[model samples]
Target: MADKVRVAVLISGRGSNLLALAEHKRRDPDRPYEIVLVASNVPEARGVVLAKRLGLRTWSLSHKGMERRLFDQKLDTVLREHDVELIALAGYMRLLSPEFVERWEGRILNIHPSLLPLHKGLDTHRRALLAGDEYAGCSVHVVTADLDSGPVIAQTRVRILPRDDADSLAARVLEAEHELYPAALERYAHELRGAIGEGREGGSDD
Candidate 1:
């Protein structure tokens, strides 16, 4: 079998989804990818601490004063150094520069708090509640140049209750995110691995 695809996860907050992904990988020995690095823009992020406890390699630097492109360039260097093949964004608050997005292209995925094409930016849960929607959900999608405008890989919907507020709906959506993200990544990685195999096998030696 081919070696597992190398993945890096970026987080800015508690990294609940990161933990879920790590736990899923640990539980399933045959997963198609391995999270080789967990990185964060916040040097003191809790996710960094959690990654350490999980015995995963980590990289972190404060993005406060740095310019966007410059920070992304430095981050790109670290990712390349780790030979990362895929990137998963879990609560990563910063917007990636367009250049950086083009560099990785379809190789990156992000978990959004709401079903995309509906709520593209922040305050998604609140907006859903205000609109009196019947359901709110989380989506895992490929990262593109446009914000939250990527092709969705998968989604998990949480039904909105009669008394649901933004916070309550957010919490339920978060739980769904934890479940959806790991499973989505697992399947996507498997597809990527198969594509690589097909390419190599179909190459002609001229």
Candidate 2:
């Protein structure tokens, strides 16, 4: 049997999406990806504690006052040390440096609260409501240097009720994210495996 794809999840807040992914792995023992590390830029992130409870290794490094590239370098070192093959960003608030994005490229994924190409940055729910959009949703995409601009792997939409406020709409999108992200990760993991197989086959002739 092939080894499971080693994954590292990065979080900055509640890590609800991280928990969703973990649950998915638990429910499906044959999942192609295994989360080996849960890392955060904030020491107080609740996800760290939950990850520890789940018997996964956890790491924290404060991004405060550090240059973006410098912080990302440290993060890169940590991920490499753990032999992480893929990275998932769940509510990880900070933007990664271009260097980091380039290094990971196709192996990094992020879940954004909006449909993407619509509301790219923060306050997505409020922006969608203010724009009078009929529907709001979440998107799981490959991470890129261009913020939320990446090839979307999966999405789940929710109707925006007329009475919905930022909080209510955000809650709806959060639910969608929890559902969509895990499915996206699973799909991507399969794709990654195929790509790796192709790479190895191509290298055999060398």
Q: What is the TM-score of each candidate against the true structure?
A: 0.96, 0.96
lDDT of 2 by residue, 1-206 (tens): 34678999999987899999999999999989999999999999998888888898999999999999999999999999999999999989999999999999899999999987889999999999989999999999998889899998888889999899999999888888888998899989888877776776677544
Candidate 1 Cα lDDT to native? 0.93
Index of the highest-lDDT prediction: 1
Q: How many clashes (backbone N, Cα, C below 3 Å) per candidate?
A: 0, 0
Per-residue lDDT value at 141 in model 2: 90
Checking candidate 1 for backbone clashes, the offending pairs are: none
Cα distance off (Å), candidate 1, residue 59: 0.3
lDDT value for model 2: 0.91
Could you tell me how far off, in angstroms, the CA of residue 56 lies in candidate 2 after the best superposition? Answer: 1.0
